[model samples]
Every structure is written in structure tokens, then in C-alpha cells.
Target: MLDSDYTQRFLFDDTDVRGEWVGLERSYAEVLAKHSYPEPVAQLLGELLAAAALLVGTLKFDGLMVLQARSTGAVPLLMVECSSDREVRGIARYDESLLAPGATLSELMPDGVLAMTIDPTNGQRYQGIVALDGVTLADSLSNYFASSEQLPTRFWLAADGRRACGMLLQQLPADRIRDSEEREASWQHLRTLADTLSAEELLGLDTQTVLHRLYHEEQVRLFEPRSIVFRCSCSRERSANAVISLGQQDAEQLLAEQGGAITIDCQFCNHSYRFDAADIAQLFAGAGTEGPSGTRH
Candidate 1:
């Protein structure tokens, strides 16, 4: 499966902190293939992709989580969504000329705020918004976790558009402790070692290989790997709802102006859904039970 992506989460038997590692290469290629983003846009997308994966690793939820930003400056919007199953999709809406090659998130989205939303398959949607004061994606996300979860966590995320990577280390409250300072000291020491991990090592090494190289002295237990892939939740029926929101008159007008047919394309995945004369007729003419239009039957 080309979707079989990179990420590793582990627990240390000696410490009360959990850790995770994630990387991306061809997985990013899948998303980049849809658009010709500028260098900064591509790099930002990679960071978002890595951030989404890090959130997936940290949160306890069985649904999709989306990280997005709406800016009033160079980049209008950037979205990165990942499901519980590790299916990821991302896009960046930006003006190429407004940003430079090595622009940071604050530079690109000057007055932007970061937001995180959770959409369960069968539950209420949850969302959170935070100010963007941090200089980098990892910094902003760390601020989000500190404010939202009130947890002491660390995140190291990196990417080059072609590949993205991340590592998360978090403190878990312990019941009994002989030396609280020792635990903190151990975590600090471990993070120092993890800090040395380079983007190349993260993107190129295997889970155990990287862990051994970083924390070979500690007792680390690696979990079974979970796969990741590019999956878009958009469908023709959903697209039809979009067209319907345009109202029957406007839809018909667009249909009439475009030869009695309308094509709805999903911006997330570039998948197009076509609605013809019969589809339009059946949609508005028949009983409401007849789904939106062009639903895969």
C-alpha cells in the first residue's frame, strides 16, 4: 500500500513519558501532485501534515481531526486533516509572490490563528482556536497543547515538502514516585537526545533503528505500526449538497450556462463529480428520498 506511511509511538518502562516519531515522503508526493505550490507553501503544507500526524499520535479519539488556519495576508487558508486510521489530506491556499522562499508561519500568516477540529464519524464535532504567537509550526502547536490540554509536552517537526517528519514526547502523571526531580531530569536528558535527531535520520531510518540510535540506553517498547494513507472524504452526494446550497435556481442557471450539466470538483482531492440533465431532473423532480445526485449506486 503506497498509503502505508511512517510514524512510531513508544513507551518507556522506566519513565512516565510517552514518545512518538513520524515521517513522510511519497505520502507527501500524493498531496503535492494535486497542485504546484511555491516552495514556502509546500514546506508549510509539510509542516501541517506533520502536525496533524503528531496530533493523531497524541489524542485519544476514533475520528478525523483537522488543523486549519485562516489568514488575512499572503495565505488565506491552510488545511491538514487526518483520520483515526491515519488517512491524511492537506492543501494550502496562498499567493505565491506574497511570500519568500524561507518564510516562517508567522511571516506567511501574519494575523492568523491556529485551529483544531475533531469530527467523529458518529458524534458531535469539536473545535478549538488559539492565537498564533509562536515563530514555527512546532512552537504554535506546543502552545496549543499547553493551553488546550494543560499538559507538558514537546514536539519536534520537520519537512522539506518532499518529506515531513515529527516526534512527540509527553509527560504522563505517575501514581508513586521516589524521585520527582529524577523523573524530570530523565525526561530532560531524553529530550536532549531526541533533539539531536536530524531530518535526514528521521525520514530515512526505521522505527527501531532510530529509537536504538537515540535511546539505546533506555528500555523502550515499540508498538505495532499503524498505516497511513491519503484519503478524501468527499463524494458526489456531498458535492451535490454543495451545488444544492447554491440553490436550485443558481444550480440550474450554471447548468443551463454550461450545457445542461454541472461538474462539482472536490478541492481537497481533485476528484470531480458530474451532474447531467437526468441527474438534475431526478434530484429536484423526484421525491426527496432520492439522494442528492450522482451518488455511487
Candidate 2:
């Protein structure tokens, strides 16, 4: 059976090329369940989720990778985040009336700016931006790699309401033994094979089966797969910190206005946290401490 919510890496043993395959089931459904998104919005968000997982799997870092698109079109913003540990969360904001049936990426987000941010726990953050000039998210991302990273990369992404899946192929830098012409020829050959993959195959087949069907004649080596999961990093402590940032006096004033309590809701997971006046007072009192002040959930 195909393993849902996992990513597997593969490489051409004889060429400077590598790839990653990601399939999402439970995680995708969990994200959708949190909101009543429209069909186009949900489908676009799913593709973004799959893209984030594919990109993050290519790196070795202890941080979060964020994929964001901003535009003044039908879809104002779409964001997806994936952590190094394989935890994923995403959300989208769009104008329903503008979303037409069977809309392409350009129709939904005309003149959009796509930004990818890498925020590491122990290092400085880095970001790259590219214009949404392509009709599909995969094409725009491929353009990003060409302009920003200067690496040849291609992506095939597909999603239904039930599951989201994606495949990525990247050409690595040539080493001393590999000549430029030979590397180019190898990349061309691999890309030719990858171009034959269909959305139906990507969404329905297992990683091993899909790779074999595409690169059956190539020297392909598959690596162990890693599980992906839906996990929100929100907590009462983080919410309390947001409240504390408003200052003690403002927090009290807000509490009074809200009938003796302030409610904070997490947009990602739809988790509600209520802080009463006493809770707010105690939270401020413990603000001087070096660690998290409020109770965790």
C-alpha cells in the first residue's frame, strides 16, 4: 500500500541529479477541516502545502521554511509552513466572489509575488522572491530556482480535496570528473523522463512505483522515507506572550471591555484560549520570570 504523509528521496547513481517525492493524506485533510475553504482556495492551498514539503526536504536545517504568495487579485495571500521535523501547517485568505470556476494560478493570483523564507533556530533567516509569471505554482517555483538559486529544478504538483502529492527533480552542481556537456546531457535525459509523469499518476501511485515507472532504465537509488504530520505550534503560553506584549494596563482594559476575559484564537488549528482578569494579572506578574509565564496546552 502507498504510505500517506511521507517523503522519500531518490538519486541517479550515475548522474548529478536528485529528486524528492511527497504524498499527503491525513495531514491535508486535517488542514482542510480547520476551515470551510472554497474549492479553488482549498486546491491552491493544497498545492502550496505539497510544495513546501518538497522544498524543505531538500535542505538540512533545524528551522521552518515558509512559502508565501501576495497579490491584489482574487487570492490576496496564501501561506504554507513546513518545519525540519516534518510538521506542517497552512492557511489562505481570498475573495470568494473573485474565484471563478476552473481558475488557473494566474487568474487567481495575477501579478503575485512569491516569497520563500528560511528561518533557522540557530542562524539568520534568508528569503528569496520571484514574480508569479507562470500559469502554475510549479512553474513559478521552477523560475525561482533558475533565477535565485541558479540550479535547474522542476516540480510536478497535484491535489484533490482528499490528498496532495508532489515530485521534485533537481540538477546538482557538476564535480571535477563530470564535464559540463555531459552534465547537461544527463540533466536533459532525466528531465525528459520526468516530463512524462501525469498528475493522475503522481496523486495515485506510491513513490517507489512512480519512480520505477519513470526511471526504470536509469540507475536510481531510493532512500528511507520520513513521515509528515499536522502539528500547530500554538499554545496558551504563546498567546499569553502576545497579550503581555500589549502591556499590563492595555490587557486589563481589554479584559474589562470583553466582560472580564479576553479570548485568543489560533487561526491555524482553530484552538480557543480564554484568559480572565485573574489569569491576565497572574500572567503579567510572572512576566518577570525567564521562561514561559502562562499555562501550556
**Tens digit per residue, CA lDDT, model 1, 28-91:** 8889988888877887788889888877887888899999987887888989999998889999
Off by over 4 Å in 2: 287-297
lDDT of 2 by residue, 118-211 (tens): 9999999999999988889889999999889567899989888888999999988776227888888888888888889898998889998998
* TM-score between model 2 and native: 0.94
Model 2 C-alpha lDDT versus the unseen true structure: 0.88
TM-score for each candidate, following the candidate numbering: 0.87, 0.94
**Best-performing candidate as measured by lDDT:** 2
